[model samples]
Target: MRNPETILEVDDLRVYYATPQGDVKACDGVSFDLRSGEILGLVGESGSGKSTATGGVLRTIGSPGRIVSGTVTLDGEDILKYDDEKMRQTRWQKLSLIPQGAMNSLNPTMTISDQIADVIETHEGRQPADALRERIMTLFRRVGLPERIYSMYPHELSGGMKQRACIAMSIALDPLVIVADEATSALDVVVQRVVAQTMLKIKRELNVSFIMIGHDMGLMAQVVDRLAVMYSGQLLEIAAVRDMFARPAHPYSEILIESVPTLTERKPMKINEGITHDPRNPPSGCIFRLRCPHAMPVCSESRPDMVEVHPEQLVACHLWKKDENGSYVRQSV
Candidate 1:
């Protein structure tokens, strides 16, 4: 079968934050692609540049933070080059964001229906009141939200309802790609599952792509088609969720997968022992070498380029080298 067409591509995207002492590399040469109708999970620890990378794509980085270099191509166009007016026009029409905190993202004063209607009116101009209400009702139903909450304020809904409401608003315009940055992070476990199911249902009905950023490995396993691991502002590995879980290519990926708790067996978490470098001053060669258990002399010499270690599995690590046949073979330290 043919591969799905690429919908969004981020190439060597670099985002930085200015500070009194130096520039912090919030997203240093991170790269990944979102396939049409596929959900890509961006997983990492806090401050791993997952959100910064998404912010750069949405042109939401402000003040001290800026896109230092690279390109974000959406539907064959480099959106990073769009003028302010064009970008604004493209936001809900072609791309949308379901921000981290639903409580903070919504307006406390405006009713949920009005808030959603405001988005529709802003992008598509004024509509008849009845038609608008019906449209909002359809969205609510699609996301499994009750229509009763449409007239209620933000403070009135439960955490799951608010999140589902946000999801409804995000799909109001039928955007080509939606960046859901920890959309369920603040919810209880039961609520998180419900919200996740709502997102999956939306994806199936709308055939839209997504970039779901979070630290939940279990959630990532259930929802994402492909997984991209991030660390120290760099993409360490990208692979199919099953392949990565079965045979993680990068050491960091292995450690991350191993850290997830299991019910059948008990094992010590492998990720809490390492110390990451300061963002402003990363070490030369491989950024993960400092914390990697398999560090070698070559790891500190020069950075390893992303190499396809197996079919459709890419990893940035010196331990895997191309042999005479051009197949990646493990090397002894």
Candidate 2:
């Protein structure tokens, strides 16, 4: 468990799209907290608002994208009101993001060293030209990349190496919390492991937290301390990694964990049916009710409230109630 001194807190975080038809709720009433040296995994199928929720914290959502309602608090401070100047100053220096498809995030035209130097030069003020090369070299070695790769362009290095270079750039200022939006989603299995390992190294060295976003349950299990499961823009569950894998309270979380591929698992993988509804116009009630096998009448009548079931374990499902005899019975997922 992370120390109670929280570094980030997101309460009822919502990001929406102002479409011609109506406002699309990309992230709806999302809330979570993070502490130093902790990794919180945000897992959901595509368009489930995994990235949108976190992206709102970075204020990276572009035009047509708007945070409809929510509060993003960093170190007990609400950042939603930050002006452009404040955002520019706080970004990368206090908080940084290694966005999804980070391979393309780097400027292909610029040298690897130049890219890292750019962030340092922009935020850290001017320095002698001679010092810039040395700083880049120090960061490269910190991320376990060869110092010789500094002069090379992004095309020269392999995917894993490029990821490491990006990591070096991400931690150049040792930001409090790093948002990694599917940081390893684009790589092969071997490279994914490599990238995850390199990320661990960087995390330990910097003692920073990570908001890792991905749908791969197994991959997230390996790195994340706590898991936040999302379904159709709403966070359905958050629990310790072991509890979430062993006894997932939410039906959505159980499906995700059971879907993880295993060596001894010769049976066909469990696949969740039904597709995510378009954000422009969503379902009438619980977003997952259409696909949720255990859903009941109440699920379709109204959305469930996120209630605390245990320490650090919150589930947004009606299943956590009792039946006639007072025995806890899960709802018809």
After aligning candidate 1 to the native by TM-score, how far in Å is the CA of 24 from where it should be? 0.9
In the order shown, the candidates' Cα RMSDs to the true structure are 1.6, 2.3
Writing each residue's lDDT as its tens digit, candidate 1 over 1-333 gives 124598998999999999998999989998888899989999988888999999999999998999999999999899999999999999988999999999899999899999999999999999999999999999999999988987999999998999999999999999999999999999999999999999999999999999999998999999999999999889999999999999999999999988999888877655465436877889999989998889999899999999889998999999998899989997766
TM-score of 2: 0.94
After TM-score superposition, the amount by which residue 328's alpha carbon in candidate 1 deviates from its true location, in angstroms, is 0.8
Worst 10 residues of 1 by lDDT: 267-276
Give each model a TM-score: 0.97, 0.94
lDDT of 2 by residue, 1-333 (tens): 234778998988889888889988889999888878889999998888888898899988998998877888887678888998888878889899887786798999999998888899899888799888887888888878997897899999998888888888889887998999888889999989988988888778788999999988889889899899987788999988888887899888877878788988598868667465767888777888777778788877888888766667888887787568765556543
Cα lDDT for residue 279, candidate 1: 78
lDDT of each: 0.92, 0.84
